[model samples]
Target: MASGSIKKEANGTWMFVVDIKDETGKRKQKRRRGFKSRKEAQAELTKLLNDVNDGTYIEPVKTTLGEYMLTWLDSKHDNMSRLTIDSYRSYIKNHVAPSIGHVALSKLSPLDIQKLVTDLRSKKDHKGRSLSASTIQRIFNIVVTSLNNAKKMQLIKENVAKLIDKPKIKKKKIEVWDVDEIRVFLDGMYDNRHYICFHLALLTGMRQGEILGLSWKNIDYEKKLIHVTQTLSHDRKEINHGAKSHAGVRSISINEKDVAELKRHAHRIEEEKEKAGEELYEDRGLVVCTNIGRPVFADTIGKMFRKYYRKFNVTPIRFHDLRHTHASLLLKQGVHPKIVSERLGHSSVTITLDTYSHLLPNMQEEAASGLGNLIFSDPQKNEL
Candidate 1:
């Protein structure tokens, strides 16, 4: 019989209600599942009814992944900056929908997802290499998140995507620059045109985007600090807003050296403006920007780092490692985890400890000391 939650007058057809609970405790009725067995269908219907009574049955609708993703993208109107959403749309269009756009909403299965991921894992792109595990994982996560939201929207009966086994992602060991390494790097940067960018990155744990987004107004050379509040993206596109975390918005301490470098750079900027004989750059008071005074792209900074590596015979690392190096150096110098968290703009102190705990000294001494004190200490209450 055709099956559904509501009754139909035709044979081989039925209507039934399902019960699914929302995030709240309230139970709701969702209708329809097409099963061939009458007894099985009856059980399913009864279970759904019970769930509705118990506040557990999630509704079922028939919207495909493509449909849900489109809605999700629309909902991100304000949460995401304009530039980011543009890239997100591009990625989805070029990499995602082309493969699975035909899959039915209700018929989507883990096997289908697993095969998609596995295939991507093996194939190379324009880079002439198989996609990195991290990239593949990100794409997979976006798809799963979109599909999960679909389930929540009652467009699908079950979130089978959750059941799929995900490939184990390895956390590559972080390569941080030691104090000597930082000194060497900065010494070399003094002669480079992008020295200001490299110097601040080495000193403060601010992200690449944050450093690039920096405005001169954000810096207090007299106070020897730089306030990091935002970041820039690729293409010098506007919409680099808000720090990665609330803590990321904190002021970073600068030294006399950084102040001097910025001073020298500022003078050069005015020289370039005079050469152009017009207000070619934005008057945003940016600390580091393009030659013409637009915001710097994150990838451009990364490429700059690569150029330095080729020039200096240094080990190749992305611009981001500068932030990691800053945190690791702080921890090595016996700075507290909370301070590191604040410096790196981690959302919480726990995040700091988790990331750097392995690099800290062993807890054996503290544990032994605690044991000794507890064993020998007298109880004040007992004495009383």
Candidate 2:
């Protein structure tokens, strides 16, 4: 039978000590202190004895939140990408570790997590601006995930992070350019060397990384399809040989005009290769590359895009906005959401719908008008 006793300490507090058998049948004393009264200590000791009898008692650990999180991150190295692991490490080292890393994992409470959220809201970056809602939410998610793992490992009785409310994230409005703006931008950038890069983004809804990672072999010229099989890391240091998600691995069909433009772009690359000579050109088979065939940095592309948009007097939009513009134009032209989702490599049509829900009202109005015309138009007019 499990047994425990409570004793009044000289410091005017109460303590409980219980003798129990561990999983290996070895006797050990579980001691807890800092109770305000003998009654309080007795109640806790009784619960401990019951837990020991039920085989639900967890051994107390002194592991701090910082230490456990570092161990957890190390465990994730083989399972996660280097970029993702780096991001998590930054959050732990820069934000989490500085704030509450010293707090013991066993003693972590919901209020502590809430305080972390509050501090993150008030914390400023190098630009003196507070952390964005999305970023704070991501950090909160990481904390919750780490605590959950601790609970699963039987290191903690509960996950305090789960008891607290998640950080609120306000969705930013999606910005896109209209068809006339697209035409104007294309007209002005036709002669630019990076024209094909932006064109593929707008035409295929391919991400900047996907476009930069594109190889000549991935394109089916006769079929007018571009297979998205790989992507470049944001820093341009690594070429990950797969899509961002399983659904991201898809084929996007291009128009005949786009195919012809791509062919012309390929011919230009061939000429550039000849001018650079065999030794000078490091042909990695990338569709878009520098004169020496090295991959262009993603940041450089963004800066160049920004410069051209300002020069052309078009409303400023980021490079990724080009993908949104592509999807928006297709949706406006009455393409099915499923088809758009497939082309954009979204995991599901629901995600596509949620992202483009703003366009639904206009689509509904058009549908209503088309329905009226179908029902009210004269038979003769229809025949003609």
Candidate 3:
């Protein structure tokens, strides 16, 4: 059974001590002082004894929020992706640490988190722009995840964040180009330097990094297939092997025309490599690169697209919408959504359907119309 005792401290304050056995069957004592009355000490002691009996007791700890968050991040290092780890570190270092690093982990409250969220929402960056709703939400999520882990570890009895409301996120409209718009854009790109990149993006739905990370080795000309095994990191300084989820590492079928275009692009790369000579040739073996054989940066590619878009006077669209454009065009052509999801490397078909649900009504109407025509039409009556 748990037991407690009250004693007068040398500092002339009442102290309470509760002794109990821990989960490991070892006896331990929790002591707290500075109460002015025996009644006050007894009240706290009673709470501790009840907690010990209920198996909900956690030993007092001096761990600060900053300390716990850093340790939590370190524990996640091996399981998380490099990009994710980096992002977490940035948020912790730049935001969480600066704001509430000194707050004791056990002492943190829902109001403290709410205040942090409010401050983050109002906080301006070096550019004098307020924090975006998404950024603030992400920070809140990180803290909540950290606190949740703490709760799971029995460091705290409750996750205060659960009591607060999550910031509302504004849904973004998915933008896509129609077939006619794509045709106009591509037709204006004849003999353009980055034609292969744009063409592969629209036709294959390959991401920018995947397109930039492509190598001759990833393609099988005879099989008319392309493999996505790696991607250029957003920073454009390193190749992230097995970059996305396992689903992202997939092989997509290409048309013969696309394969022919790829071969031409390969040949052009060879000529450029030769022109650069042995000394200047970086020999990275990437399918897309600069004149000097260096890996082409993603920003440079985006800027190139933007420049061409302005010059051609086509509808203004971000380069990423090309992937959306490809999916949209295929859906309009009556292609199955599962196939589109696989080609786009989405983790699930549900994501594909959700993203393109707007287009589904038309397809459903067509299906209904076709079924009605088949069921209601009478060839014999029509002949008569």
Position 276, candidate 3: lDDT: 87
TM-score of each: 0.78, 0.94, 0.87
lDDT of 1 by residue, 256-338 (tens): 87788889998888876667656565656677876777777777778778877677776667788887888888877778788
lDDT of 1 at 154: 68
Error of 1 at 196 (Å): 0.8
Runs in model 2 lying further than 4 Å from the true structure: 367-384
Candidate 2 global lDDT: 0.90
In candidate 3, which residue pairs clash?
none
Name the runs in model 1 displaced over 4 angstroms.
Answer: 1-60, 165-167, 279-282, 360-384
Residue 273's lDDT in candidate 1: 68
RMSD of 2: 2.1
**Candidate 2, residues 1-384: lDDT per residue as tens digits?**
888888888999999888988778899888899999888898888887887788787887899998999999999987788899999999999889888888998889988898889889999999999999999999999999999899899999889998988888777788888888898999999988889999999999999999999999999988999999998888888888888889999999999999999998988889899999999999999988997788889998999999989998888998999999999888888898999999999999999999987855678788899999999999997788
TM-score of 2: 0.94
lDDT per residue (tens digit) for residues 1-384 in model 3 = 799999998888999887889778998887888999888999999988898888887876789888999899999977776778899998988888888778889888888888788778878999999988899999999999999999999899989888999987786777787777778888888577678999999999999989999887999988889999989887778887874777899998999889988888878888888898999989887888888888888899899899888887777889998998899889888898999999999999999988887855687788899999889999898789
> Which structure among the candidates has the greatest lDDT?
2
Write the candidate numbers in order of decreasing lDDT: 2, 3, 1
Assess each prediction's global lDDT (C-alpha) against the native.
0.73, 0.90, 0.87
Lowest-scoring 10 consecutive residues by lDDT in candidate 1?
Answer: 1-10
lDDT-best of 1 and 3: 3
